[model samples]
Target chain A: MMLNLFHLTVLSFISSLKEETLPVAEFVNKSVKWITEKFSWFFDPIKNDFGDKLEDFADMLAEIPPSIVIVLVVLIAFFITGKKFGLATFSLVGLLFIYNQQLWEELMLTFTLVLVASLISVIVGIPVGILMSKSNLAENIIKPILDFMQTMPAFVYLIPAVAFFGIGMVPGVFASFIFATPPVVRFTNLGIRQVSKELVEASDAFGTTGSQKLFKVELPMAKTTIMAGVNQTVMLSLSMVVIASMIGAPGLGREVLSALQRANAGTGFVAGLGIVILAIIIDRITQNLNKESA
Target chain B: MPVIKVNNLSKIFGKKTKEAQKLLDEGLKKEEILEKTGCTVGVNRASFEVEEGEVFVIMGLSGSGKSTLVRLLNRLIEPTEGDVEIDNENLAKMNKDDLRKVRREKMSMVFQKFALFPFKTVLENTEFGLEVQGINKEERSKKAKEALELVGLGSFIEQYPSQLSGGMQQRVGLARALANDPEVLLMDEAFSALDPLIRKDMQDELLDLQEKMQKTIIFITHDLDEALRIGDRIALMKDGSIVQIGSPEEILINPANDYVEKFVEDVDRSKVLTAENIMKRPETVDIDKHGPRVALERIREQGLSSIYVVDRSRNLKGYVTADDVSDAKKQEKKDLKEILRTDMPTVEKDTSIQEIFDIIHDASVPVAVVEDGKLRGIIVRGAVIAALANGNEVNGDDA
Candidate 1:
């Protein structure tokens, strides 16, 4: 009862603002409508005609048996992270296959999206992290933006992304990018900042220039934390794939959403299985990369 | 000409605020802010000159600003007021490019932590400074290898800093600094972090390196023993100002005040005092090395407290006191090392007098300063007592 009262109070407050602040509220409302209309034409094609293209992108990837790729990836994990990790890699894949709905094509699209997003995340995230760590002003300005980007609801991110680029793999890629980037930036900053003060001073004492200090001391010390952030980014990006399908994004998210709409439990279960497999594959690869670096 | 000169240098931190920044920018004195806000004076109106190829030490306790003073010389921290002239160039006003160039070409430093890069192997850490100067990677590798060899880390080039002991890590740190071949090396308590035995070895290694490299070093440490052993001249600092600057001998013999005297009071003089403190003129030494009974007869007849021993080259060998001869009287044949207590109160010729007292206290024997393992003269208890009292050479014979 108290919670309902509190919700009522908040809703009343918002409703009162519309009356008391008409012009300002109207301005916000019209601006949003105008933006939606201006961009509506561009999005019409993705809504109307892009389904076959996305389906084919999904299909092309789906033809490869996940078990083969899983085995290959497990071997690679062993090569990179050693035998102890390879066993975990194989076991995790087996669990995903048994538990998931097992639609291979949809899973492949999710896997490709995660791989591309994680790559972009690292490339962009590290430099920003280095810059923020080096400059106090940059850190102060960038921190709040990163906080907002990470904490806001995932669906809310889709709204702006759709408004800008419309609903398709492009918008899906972009939404996942926004959702996944915060951990990388935050961790990169943390890793660089946490480097030992004595070590940094020692480098300075040895007459190392600013650039050498960064490359030789700061970056290397920051590697463990930065890799952790990369792992989080991969996980976060994969999480967004299923959510992106709500707005006509192809692959496992679409299959799951469509199956749910029709109440077809078998279709939904199989698609969910594929998504799980894709998630496991990505998680293993990135986790192994981190261990190898370590 | 002096290789380095510092004049009227001071560093004032946090002098400006929102209300008073304009006044400071317009050349207000720091004292004027005493009524409003506060400021920390890191380096007071300090002045000193270091001659070429001298190991000039700045000794101070933590927060005394000796470290800050050295940093000021390199413009690592810019001075609020004054000039640092290194090889005749004013460092305070150097542009960034020039300052960077100067640091690259003329000054290297070793930190207490032995700041080896944990990410890179020892060889790579050594090469990093040279790499900053835009040297090619291959050249850097070769130079770094040579530097590692210099510091005796040649076999461990592939090892990361984590794999090495503290002493070995410091060696890599030293190698990195040496790789630059800077004319002036600044060490801020560089060996203070090592264990006692390692500290001693590092000190000896530093002295050997100084002998070979001929690099002028400005070493900072709170350990007076280290200062006495390694410094050609030492500047003792208290607070932000120098208390005394002199050779170790002058400091031990004539400490400027109660502060310097108290610092010297506990130093083991045996390690610090040299043969020069104890040796007499060679012609004045009337005893032979192994004549034995005759020298004992002379001691009884003359009522002497101690007798000096010298080699054919007129260098100090050791000294035998009246007590040692009497003790040796019962034995038929006595070698000098056995008769002399073997552990004689001895010092290097360059040891300070304060250190002499330290050695005297430890060995409980009369002091002798040695040159090439032979005696110069004997500074018996009376000689040191008289020197302490009269502040110079004593005129009285041993009682």
Candidate 2:
């Protein structure tokens, strides 16, 4: 009976992979048609009102010469991460000016959303990690769930998120969170588990209570690994931003996706550059913060 | 009076009675507990005591329950059946809170591995014990600084544990224990992990510390030399039970059992013996410094080849002999170095008897004398033989 079940499971898994490939091809096929329909909807009265409001805001931002603010932020980041990363950052931002794309506001919006999602992931992931460490049953049950969440594609995560929240910024946030949370949890667990047994015993010998050990010994030693986890989470969130834009998540992701649909390579390329610039800044800044803390 | 005592601390493992009995029936030693139960028994029905300020050493081979027995004292591991009384308090029945209070206030342990917190700075690791006692950060930091000074690592306070060498890290561990200033210090092979030279340095450091702050110490070691060097009373354990517990002198001259005798038989007993054991009594006449005939008569009267010379002030001058006086007469002017065997080894009055044989083997001399700078009296191999023959009964004349 076990052998028959194993054979059946293998056949089903192979079939699922073949079945999932069909939707990917179909998605590319209908791209042009979808873009035209999307363009017409943008001109509709209600949609036009929203687009005009956003356009006006972008125009106001354009008048301020964002290069000044970008420079200031870049300098502050440089102070945190050091000069090598700072100069690399300035060059990436300079590319945005060279491309002369009108999607700078969209880039900022995407950056904000990813930052928010990753911060929340870290805050929530740590407690779950501590709980898993404390209880064997919890660890056992969570292990398979965590493994599944990590192994599944971030795109697959979008379906359930969209089904629950529907298409908007909220669903985009939900998707980004699901995409980014696994590393935070995995690294936190590893960090806590890696603390020295001798240190643990020393603290115990000194009559350190449970909370004291967790705070004084366990948390401090786990800090480096947890920060590394945060690094991974940020990178993962950046990867999900463009995918999130399909659900009306306003950002460089949406700008790039729309440009791609119309085969506007110049526009798409510029938006893609903006995304890369944002990813690099966020990655460098958080990584430096972690290094300092460690 | 016994400040701490233990009784019948047997720890059996596995649920099967037949297996335990079968192993016992096969004449397995208590150390064979691991092979039978598949679980290690750290302490086996062991018992001993420490006086108010005694430096008691529990010496044994690895896995002989020395470390476990020390842990059992502080309730680090709960004893299976024994009652451990610490200063009239029943530790076996204390609740967790009370036990914590006891550890925080009365006792502290130094680990063999020097369990300093790797992430914390040396200052922070040293202050950890005080922090656990709920002292505020500023106050504990002050105390930790003081402790670092005590162990002579004051300048390395801000450095992390990884920055320090093994000896420095263990000094921090010792400072951590000392920071709390508990009444009882339990050292679980704390210096065993350092390099041999560093181990010697740490031992000297501990001896200096002990002189200033005489806390009751329960030190554990597998090294016999370390036991003899530091222990006020040494307990030699085999299988699980203590074969003997006494001063290093008593154990060397008269071991309580054949096992202890076999353990110390190959050891150099001269290094462990004190000068008092080898010194001649006041009734024994000293050989005259200038009379050749009289010195020879005194040597023959004492049935010894040599006799010690001393001034009327009772200060040792040097050892003299009938041959020394005759040689002095043959030569008009005598060289003091040739007349006297100033090369003879001497030891402190309280040195262990084992050191005597050790010095004699190395020196290949007939006798070594007990002295205070100059020779007081001679202790020939005959004295040691007489003491060994009489065993512990050699209480008066021999040693």
Candidate 3:
């Protein structure tokens, strides 16, 4: 009897709101299609320009022989981090391990994707974050928008990204950018806001202009925090590669996706290990950059 | 002439400043004005003038608007109402570019926290003011080096501010201000963060610098002892308004109201009151005119056992005791010089009362207040005791 009553309530609720009558999904689809049709000229140029540059960069990374790439990364690790031999050796061994798996080209492509996505996120995110820090109006408006971008499921954004940029590396880059951008923006704003009040007052007392204070005092003091933001962006972008490969992006992510389809556990495990190695190398390098600046 | 003149200056910090200003003009108290307009009155109608070469101090407890008042002098914190004139030019009327120029050239500030840029070396910090003025690199560095030498920080120029002690960092802060060779220096509690010994040393260093440079200084501090020690003149503030403005002696002797009296109640009077403050005109015998008989008569008339003998120019030759005058009279001496006691206690007019205690303790007569051999006044033992016991009473009626 109790089960019958529950079923009756569910039936009544279901009858009141039909999916076709709601029309929310359809409205969103139609608006997206109309906007694309009307504004393709505006978006197409930007998309083409970014797509060409990104592809060229990826090709450049691929053109380098695996041995030369490993040595170059090892040298960079040593020089940029104040001659830390441990870090340099670790980077060399890590790259060699990835190379041994015969996944070198796939790792390079994944590296390029993460690099481009992180770069775009930083370039767009920093100034917006600065703007947010400087004005209360910008902070109030951007804060909720950043919250939505960060909290909404990463998969949900891929749909709109595909509608706008189509299914290719560009859409994958676009999707990864959307997923990775919030941290850099949030940390930039937080970093600038955390600058000591006394330091700001001192700069003003010395007659510094608004721009001079921002560059000379605020940015230098906020270097570590902003670098932390960049590190987070890199990691987030790396995490999104597999999810992004569902839309035709190529990389270790594509290998993992193929392995999943074939139900091949060994292939999937090796690709996953490669991704982990890449993440650790990049993370250590960025953290060392942060420490050196500090 | 005044180097800086602040006229009817007021600063209300909050969004409702306009309404707060109206309430202020309507004669509302700070609390009442805040309640009516939801604004904090940082400074309220403060008016004062800082003379050239004078150490003008603005002193108050925390949240009394003394810090705000100094910032307003250089327009670091804009005033809601009023005008500050540096030389003859009105600061309130100047545009942003002109204000910056003034800050760069005419005024420099030393912060309470020794606001040296943490990333900058001592030399770089010292060069900040000159760099802001667009001076050439070579010239600015030379000037910065000179300024650092002036503050005794030349050896530490290569070190970062974090590497220096609090006193050393504050010296770098001072050097930074001096590097501009500004006409006015605004120091906001420049030594309050230092240890007591270091604070005293810094005060003496500032005095030494003042003696050589003679630059006009406007210093802010919450400590009364610091103010008394350094200020040529002090303005005391309470609840965002200046309650009194006077020399340290004037403030101590005649506090304006109950608030000021309470503020100064714990002060050690002997350190503040000088011989000039407690001295009086002395009974004297002239060396050029008065003979032994006249000297003895004058001493007896004044009911004293001795009298100071001065030459025709009032040059304090010495003091003559009554017994010595009588002996001179019995011997029919023509020269009063022989009767003169040149070893009698003598002190400068500016000597503090504390120094006078030892001088008067063993003296047979009043101590002569002398300056460059001229007799200024005389300090008696009784006067010092009376002044100490009734310290606040001296200037009680003046307020």
Report the lDDT tens digits of candidate 1 across residue range B240-329: 778899999788767899898888878766455544644444222333556556557766775776666665666555557777677677
Predicted complex 1: CAPRI docking category: acceptable
Compared with the true structure, what per-residue lDDT tens digits does model 2 show for residues A186-283?
78888888888777777778888889989999989899998998899989888888899887777888988999899999888888888887776777
In candidate 2 chain B, where is summed lDDT lowest over 10 consecutive residues?
Answer: B282-291
Reported per model, the fraction of native interface contacts reproduced equals 0.50, 0.70, 0.57
Candidates 1 and 3, the one with greater TM-score: 3
Off by over 4 Å in 3: A1-23, A46-49, B22-27, B326-338, B394-399
DockQ of candidate 1 compared with the true complex: 0.33
Give the clash count for model 1: 31
A6-90 in candidate 3: lDDT tens per residue? 9999998898767448778899999989977898986686568877777787888888888899999999899888887987898
Model 1 quality (TM-score): 0.78
TM-score of chain B of each: 0.73, 0.76, 0.92
Candidate 1: stretches off by over 4 Å: A1-19, A22-60, A63-68, A85-102, A205-210, A262-270, B15-36, B275-378, B384-399
